[model samples]
Target: MKMFLCFFVLFILGFDDSSSQGNVNKAIKILTKQVKKLQESNKANFEATNMKIETLKNESQTNVKSLDEKITNQYETKVLKLENLIEQTNLTKMDVNSLFGEITNQTEFLLKAMDYKLGILKVGNAECSQYNILNEADRGISSGDGDNCDSTGLNTSPMWKGASWYRFLPPAGTILSQAAPGEDHCGTWLSGWCNATLPTVPGSTLDIEICFDYSGFQCWIAYDGKVTNCGTYFVYYLDNIRDCTVNLRYCGAN
Candidate 1:
């Protein structure tokens, strides 16, 4: 009877141990499934955040480009208006100065843009050098000395410490007549005498453009026989003068 009772207790204990082991394995599997779901959720959130940042970056770049284009168009419009104004009037010294004063208020970039748009010639590096005055026997006509600063067909005057002067031959068939006399302050004076004629029309008077900038930063233009203080350059029309020379004074140049 005692051996029978001991065998029955061992069987009961072995069955209970097996059942406990099975319950522990089921709990581990449930915990592993929860961990994988959490990992996937975190990965999705990270990718969404990166996508939002990239979208904002692209938008900011597009806005900057649009603003730049708008500003450029506005500047171009302003240049067109200025050209129209100049063409409509015979600008006096004060008128020209007033125009340039407004222009100078703009930034350097705008000035360069306006210059290019107008196709105006800014003295190049080759034309910036200084030159000496060549005295003439008579104030009637003076020829250009082949100096470092004087190019062929162009005469340069000594950039007096306070002024600048220049003379250039215009294209053929352009009409020109004498205007005001050159300022005495320009170191040397060259009279209006041009031997050059239009190749297209024999004996036709050649147009001579004389440019000068005074201490007051004034410039003028001569049409027919009248002198009108125009923009940044001076123009003087002359008749059958053998040689044309005018001393130029660089107004604000160092």
Candidate 2:
């Protein structure tokens, strides 16, 4: 009986040890599975975070490129506009210079013609005082009155008739007739005499006499006229008048 009781106690002790070892083995397996699951979750989160970072980098690069293109386009447009303005300014300056040159040439020619007329008048007076017949012929018979005259004693008519002289009848072969009948000649002169004829081209130095029939007022060309060699004399005259009056305004003599 003592041996049997001892054997039963030993069996109970062995069974308890076996059961504890089995429970330990099961707990170790469950902990290992949980560790594996946590590792996988962490790896997935890391991949998702990396993808978001890459997306943000790509978006920033695209935005920068777009902004650079817009800036480049704006600068190019501004440069083009500036170039156009410069070209326009250069053209305007050239036009102004050309007009000024034409006016200067006309003025010089007019002055020289007046000086020649005065010298001729002086010579004629000196020669006439010594000889009686020559003086008589110069005074009464064949001396032309103004600077521009024919060999005959008859007075040469002006090219344009103003309002003051419109009523007066011109001699035969008159090219233009005056329109206004009153006492003011505020229009253009359209006759061949006023224009340069022999050896005279457009813009040539010609002696032009502008007569204002007003008692005390004189008329002059308002601006320089450009001559053109059109077959029709009337057309050439009109073109010259148009150029002469380009910048003219009426102002009463004080």
lDDT of each: 0.37, 0.36
- Over the full model, what C-alpha lDDT does candidate 1 score relative to the true structure? 0.37
Error of 2 at 248 (Å): 35
Clash count, predicted structure 1: 13
lDDT tens readout by residue for model 1, 101-206: 8777665545654564475634332222232222222221122222212222335433211122232222211122123234332123322222222222111223
- Give the clash count for each candidate: 13, 0
Candidate 2 Cα lDDT to native = 0.36
Of candidate 2, the 10-residue stretch with the lowest lDDT total is 132-141
- Per-residue CA lDDT of model 2 for 1-254, tens digit only, reads 44754665565455654477766566557556666777888899999999999999999899999999999999999999989998998998899899889988877655644554455322222211221111112111112222222112223223322111111111221222222111232221211122223222222323223222222333333222222221112111221223322222111110
